[model samples]
Target: MSIPIDDLPDIPADLIDEIKAFLRLDHDEDDPAIAEMAGSASLLCESFTRQLLVARMAQDMLPVKNVWQKLSRLPVQAIDLVESVAADGLTQELSSDDYIVDIDSDGQGWIRLQTAVSVSRVRVSYAAGLVADWEEVPTMLRQGIVRMTGYFYANRDSNDVHQLPHAVSALWRPYRRMRMG
Candidate 1:
């Protein structure tokens, strides 16, 4: 059975009201209502974060299986659309980071491909000190000075560097395989 958004636990109306109240307070800093609203929004954010983590896990495991099974029953034309997009380089590396392989109910679906690469800095730290002089410097200064920085980078520099090549290929695989057979 598919998990529905409606089935998820609801956010209380009072909490939502508080969020609105806080937003209003942000505009008018003198309002005492802002404090209560800020507190409510913080609590709500934490609650939603937890719920989102659970939901993501369920989505990753469950919906993938269900979608694949459903796709298997789709018409040949839908599969063909996917193959056409793949052949046309719709999943090419210059696109954004996410791609949609749509298989419409009418047996005609299209592939929308996006590719993105993100680079971020990673800090590595080391401590080198005379064992006897370790206590002379403040802990905060020592910690700050001992850090080294490096970048974690990924880019689709070429057409082959795209992350979803298999998913894109899989989108058309059924049709191609069928044609071959």
Candidate 2:
């Protein structure tokens, strides 16, 4: 399960204006609505590519088992909290020495226990993504978001984007390699 500990980043208003520039239109009359479109497009692009455009805190819960298990999101930035909740509603904070975080698996994150516990007891709080702020988001992702926002804004009349666009595809291919199909 995925538990978000913070609010997802908002699509910057300036970006909405950039999309507007691309579409050759202007004014704050529709700025609020256009900004909303930018956010929606960011969501779609992130979902399609399985990438977190901005860093956020989240907790991923995994069932107990002897083997290693993958974390909920990609490009695992850091692991903050590790706790094991028992069947009788008891939660024990796990020591950092007890487990390992393996982000070397490309985009995927992995964790393995040093010792076994009861079933369904593992919980991990971590930061996962490329950057922590919208201003610091990668150029490719930002461009992709702008393009996607343009697509969404233009398609308001028809809603006919049947699939992900090629430019976005090219931007995401390498990142998608480690994501499970």
What's the CA RMSD for each of the models? 24.5, 2.4
Query: What TM-score would candidate 2 get against the native?
Result: 0.84
| Model 2 lDDT tens row, 1-181 | 9777876677676787777888788567878778888888777766766777688877888887767888877668887778998788678888777787677756567888887665577888888887777888777777777777777777888867798678876765555534446
**Which one wins on TM-score?**
2
lDDT of each: 0.26, 0.76
Top-lDDT candidate index: 2
Count of steric clashes across candidates, in order: 6, 1
Candidate 2 yields a Cα-based lDDT of 0.76
Instruction: Report the lDDT of model 1 for residue 1.
Output: 26
Steric clash count of candidate 1: 6
Q: Which ten residues in a row have the lowest lDDT in candidate 1?
A: 147-156
- Clash pairs, candidate 2, are 64-120
Error of 2 at 172 (Å): 3.7
